[model samples]
Target: MKANDLNKWLVQERARLIDNYLNLIQKCLGGTIYEDPPLQALGSDKFDPVLREYGWDWPSMAHTMIGQKRLGNIRQLVESVLGNGIEGDFIETGVWRGGACILMRAILDAYHITDRCVWLADSFEGLPPPNEEMYPADAGDNFHTFNDLRISLETVQHNFQKYGLWDQQVRVLKGWFKDTLPNAPIDKLAILRLDGDMYESTWDALNALYNKVSIGGYVIVDDYHVVQGCKLAVQTFLAEKRLSPVLQEIDGVGVYWQVANGTSSS
Candidate 1:
């Protein structure tokens, strides 16, 4: 199947899972559990205004599950924390459709953080050849071809513009993390969202940007639980550096870590 088709399928599957989970959560909380309400009600009402502002339309309930329910939870958490901070800018190392960035920009606007910027860094060329150390012996090429899956900087820029986010607060850095991260014009980051799929990409991003993450800041590894290599890289790096942070799992795939103390301002 084509990438778009695959994405559609993935979105559908994820949405189904989210619906089940939401119902389960409501049951646990003793709330009324409705079956797949309108897409607008799939998640929280707080996100509805932003979603409408961005011209986001959910053709299927599953689309809302993937886009709003699953991904929306992560966006809400980051926005709630970083949206009120005075520390640093927002950064996303691997952006696919620019959805998360758009959500973040909305949060920035809603919070009136005019001075802080959001840096978007992506190759747009797809995944680089995986280093063997990062991949399992049994892993195949199924997840390797990002060439067709990756969205270009220009495309993402257009996305930002479409969402009315193409202002001074948004910056796009185009190239591989290994080469572009050093010169990405960012001093520090309050929220660093890592979406890189492989070990090498994750490692490069962490090494280059982790030090710049402010205390009380958040580091969101998008593929942490979904991709074994990505998880390994994060664990290995934390082990080697002797650094540990509280990790919260979102959507069973993403991991969010908060720096231990709020003393440092990097």
Candidate 2:
């Protein structure tokens, strides 16, 4: 075989491996590869396509709550950044179980890209009680009351290791978004995924990190349509910044958009 043929074959092989690796990540994280979680009706067809498509039901032992479609959305955005030469790292604020970040890191490894980082910013103690005084949209929110939302930092780190994707390029920013996002070490981001699930959490992420997203990068809102507070925060920030990027929907609940060059707020 000629040298060009060998190179083509190598590229094709790598692509196939990456595809397979990502598919497995989806199944594992979605809990489809395992028996139905504890609460599912015994033998009730463990797979719930509608819930999995929109991430409406949380699998007891799965690493993510965003479901298969949203997870696939993250994969698409991260790959889009790599393909388009978008400069900077990838970050998911409000990371739970670190599934999305794990996938991001795994993708980077498959592509052999070393410069970019995968950052997870989360409280690791679950959502904060709504600060109604400051964020009216979050008033009466009860996410803070859910113990399941509180996945410790140690567990998330273990999740990263479970996939053998933990490495120097994957970092963590632990604290509430209000305290951590403004000081996040990222210089620029190719993808900003927000799953904070409330007005304050969502708004804080955008206020601190949205401008740092590179032009042509992506901003993925995991709860844009499902959570009233999240939706409000997204709309309010876009209006405040005068950014009107066209949103791409993910299973009707999540949305993403590529940043336009001049969309950065002054």
In model 2, which runs have C-alpha deviations exceeding 4 angstroms? 38-47, 264-266
Q: For model 2, what is the error of residue 170's alpha carbon versus the real structure, in angstroms, after optimal superposition? A: 1.3
Residues 23-87, model 2: lDDT tens digits: 99888887767734533422333557666656777667888868888889888888888998999
Residue 236 CA displacement from its true place in model 2, Å: 0.8
Clashing pairs in 1: none
How do all models score by TM-score? 0.69, 0.93
Deviation from native of the Cα of residue 42 in model 1, angstroms: 23
Q: What lDDT score goes with residue 149 in model 1?
A: 47
Q: Which 10-residue window of candidate 1 scores lowest in summed lDDT?
A: 26-35
Point to the candidate with the largest TM-score. 2
